[model samples]
Target: MSWTKVVAITGCDSGLGWAIAARAAREGLVTIAGMYNGSDTEAARALKNLCAHPYKLDVTDSKSVTEFQNYVKNVLQENPKYKLYAVVNNAGVMTVGNYEWQTPQMIENMINVNLLGAMRVVSSFLPELRKNGAINDFKPRIINVASHCGLQALPCFGPYSASKAGLLAWTRALHLEHFRDGLSVISFIPGGFIGSSNLTMNQVENGNKMLSHLTEEQKSIYEKRIRTLNKYLGQASNNTRYDSLSNEVIIETFVKALIDNKPKQVYKVEPWRYKFYYNLLKMPFPDIMYYWIIKKFLAFPDSE
Candidate 1:
């Protein structure tokens, strides 16, 4: 009996995750989509229409992940030819603010969903993925959807950057640890698709919550800047032109990463401008110069 390949993806409610699942299904792979909003959502319905399996999954909750794992196991049992091939950790959330403005819960939530959440899903399915790879004579891959923020920290993205950086580090470690077992792990950086994704959907509300927790002195110091930042985020999140191009490039990169015979350790999809910025950051530049360039590029408000 010939085996069919299967790929399980998290955060398929919208954006990159949904796009990847749709593409995988179109490519004749059995796609399992883990949607945080449950299987009753419009996104889930759309995925089902595309012939992908959509399940309610909350990566931050171990119980939810376990249930998802069980569901996948049942899928394999029901379809003997279906072999789990890849796990894509694409579910993430982002909130923008100064480090001082981020509450403990905000920081925790970012790390939980962006960093630890991936770990939970991988841990639950890794043994099976390894077994399938060993028996099937193929390499099982873990594609972690990281961000360029992990490579370079930008103002107002402290917690988000930290979480992504941790994820990158973990991906490297896992890859090295499991190399002999024929497991492949890589990071995929889908740069700056704010408009196409729900990542920044709560920017305004989160800004308000951040302000509510600030002391009078803190508010006086940060209120104007926070409002400016929020406005900037709102505008950036509505720039459909750039978002459309970014989505296309990112989806293309994902397709390559999924099917390439010898996949790269990191696949980054970004505009030439961001590529230039990353190159400049790599040069031996002074801290002041880096800060100045980033401030100008990001339009951060000057310190009072």
Candidate 2:
């Protein structure tokens, strides 16, 4: 019998993770979806209907990751033909606020999930992936779902940006470390999908939490700015104009990163405007121009 390719994806509860999981199943790969919310949700039911294996996975918990790893090991043991082909580190969370406004827990949560979580999953599964690659004489890819904010930090996305930047750096280092082992590690920036994803779903809640931590004097100074930031974030999350590409478009780039014979170190799916702006930043430009453009684009409140 021929080898059957299998893929594991995290954050299958919603958004890009759900879309990508569905697409991967349709592509004839045996998909194992890791849903944080477990099998109770509509997404889990839908994935089950698709014949994809959906399991409760909490990347933040070491025990949960180990359990998920064991589950994958069982699948391989049960189906000898099955070879772990790829692992998609898609689990991530985000919040919006100025750096000072963000709480310690908020920053820690982003780092724990976006950066350390991916690291945990990768470290847990690398042995299996490397073993499969060696035995099957085929390369297995590790696709990290990164963000454009990682490339250029935005004002209200301090923690989120830092997390993604760390993820990207780790991706680069891992890619080099395992290149000769027939393991492909890369980062995929899904670009601006604010309208479609649950990334900024808790903007208001986060804003409230941030505001509660401030002194009365601090609150008087920062309340308007925080409110402005929250309003802008809400609008951006709801506005289709801010998110140009459909889920299908984003997943197509993801598929390319998964199946390409010579995949790039980074696969970025972004709008033309973002492409232009990012390119412009690469040129010999002044810092003021870049910040000015960002201030206008994100509707940042004026400093006192």
Candidate 3:
């Protein structure tokens, strides 16, 4: 295998995935962007412009994953001069509200796409990495994009937080298993709110529809949580001119991980204060009390 840095990223149609793919391409790394919406005009245009080869990869579909794996394998086998250097499992969907309100399918989708999807990509790409390893140019890396929610149980973000928390554990386990395999594993946790890209307004709209089945009291409590959360999300989305944190942080961090001689296992973006809440959740007495006080005000269903 030839030693040219090539990275495979899932969910490259938008958000941090898109941002990271663009950055990797700009850095002259051969970037394979696997996106569910690759047929979309915006994705097409960007793929063309960035020289990013776009693959229609639905992470939730086993067939699609197999196809992607075969395509990558074929391309590398034909060349034998280039190999996949990194895989970014960045495809994710966010869900809001309490666990009791979430349907079985909704919860399953979150777990499948956000958590299981990453596992699928890692497994599929392992063979290629091992092949490259035989040729002495393979220093495989896997970066899983988790969130601050992974570290803590927020008042109403049941599905999202649970999935991410599972991902965090999964990545840590992978890191422990392959510490000597020259496989650099990074689980990136971006704290606070980051602006959206591929996850458009339509997601929020559809999510609201799902919650529409709730009773008036449940709806009232849900609305209160949304009102508080929306304040932060809305500000991040609209107020770009005012200290807006870019998704580019994820791209840069990925690059650093790829290039660094000894990359750290976990990168918590947005700093200490934001990371505090997540760590606080792991604490004993005060942590439980802290979350209880906030949930008390939100008037959770249990309280009612």
- Model 3, 1-304: lDDT tens digits are 2477678889876667777777778888888888787545576477658787778899999899999888777766776567777888989877555676666777798899999999999899976664554445356778899987787667667888899999999899988877677676788875544455533223455446546756788776666555444444444445222112265665577678666667799876766555454455556667569777556533334433
Cα lDDT listed for each candidate = 0.86, 0.86, 0.71
Per-model C-alpha RMSD = 2.3, 2.8, 4.4
Better of 1 and 3 by lDDT: 1
Q: Estimate each model's TM-score.
A: 0.94, 0.92, 0.81
- Candidate 1 at residue 303, lDDT? 50
Clashing pairs in 2: none
Judged by lDDT against the true structure, how good is candidate 2?
A: 0.86
Residue-wise lDDT of candidate 2 within 20-103, one digit each (tens)? Answer: 888888889999999998977778888888889999999999999999988888998999889899999999999887788889
Cα displacement (angstroms), candidate 1, residue 203, comes to: 0.7
Tens-place lDDT digits, model 1, residues 1-304: 4778889999888777888888889889899999998999777887799899999999999999999999999999998888898999999999999889988888899999999999999999999877766764566789999999999988778999999999999999999888778778989998877777777777888888889989999998889988878776766656332113336778889988887777888998879888878788888989999987787666655654
- Candidate 2 has a TM-score of 0.92
In terms of TM-score, the best-performing candidate is: 1
Off by over 4 Å in 2: 235-245, 283-286, 299-304
Rank candidates, TM-score, best first: 1, 2, 3
